[model samples]
Target: MKSEYILKTEEDTKNMAKEIAFDIKNKIIFLNGEIGAGKTTFTKYLVEAFGLKDEVCSPTFALENRYETENGLIIHFDLYRLKSEEELDMIGFYDTLKENATILIEWADKFNIEKYIKKYNIISFKIEDNNIRAVTIK
Candidate 1:
């Protein structure tokens, strides 16, 4: 079941993330958006909604950030700096998928989307206007 939502500001984006968080269960979510878009902001709210107390930030430099929540672990990945899919293997990407965790990936376009199609709920974010964003889920 796919869905679409419109967010007018950062707050709206966060709220939308919270709503989506409730429906997720051991799933993967791919967040696609441009720089300065609300991907990280949405992720922060999603983590919070999962009852995580730690701060949520972009993993651009760190590559990935893992948070342990009451439900399970949440793995956030930023592929902006990744040179190739081969690097994912070196970093134990497949190992992460072995766990019953929720994964949210940013800059997912850099990777092969088909690899995760069966296990992921894809969310694509697009700027509709200066203060508005359209998020589509499939």
Candidate 2:
């Protein structure tokens, strides 16, 4: 099953994240969207809802960022720079899934979906306008 939502601004995005926070537990969330789509912004809201006080930024350069939260740990991964599945293995990608943590991965299309089958909840975002975005959850 899938659900869709339209967000008109940053606040709308945060509100949506708040709603999702109630149901998200130690699960992996795959975020798929184009550049400038608001994936990072949505993640920031989710992390904040989880009680993170520090700034939340994209892990594009660092590859991953780990945030400690009351619920557990939230691992944010940016796979934009990763070139191959071998590289992902070298970095212990598979092992991360075994940990008791919530994962939010950006640019998830870069990885093979087979590896995450039945292990993740996938969400896709599309920019509808300068201030509006359509989010789909599956």
Report the number of the highest-TM-score candidate: 2
Across 1-138, the per-residue lDDT of candidate 1 in tens digits comes to: 439988997778768877778677578888888987788888888888888868888999998999888867889999899888899889887677677878888887887855745777778888876768888998
Question: Which stretches of candidate 2 lie above 4 Å from their native place?
Answer: none
Quantify all predictions' global Cα lDDT against the true fold: 0.82, 0.84
Question: RMSD of each candidate?
Answer: 1.7, 1.7
TM-score of each: 0.91, 0.93
Q: Give candidate 2's error at residue 118 in angstroms.
A: 2.6
Which parts of model 1 have CA positions greater than 4 angstroms off? none
Candidate 2, position 134, lDDT: 94
Per-residue error for 113 in candidate 1, Å, reads 4.7
Pairs of residues clashing in candidate 2: none
Lowest-sum lDDT 10-residue window in model 1: 113-122
Error of 1 at 135 (Å): 0.6
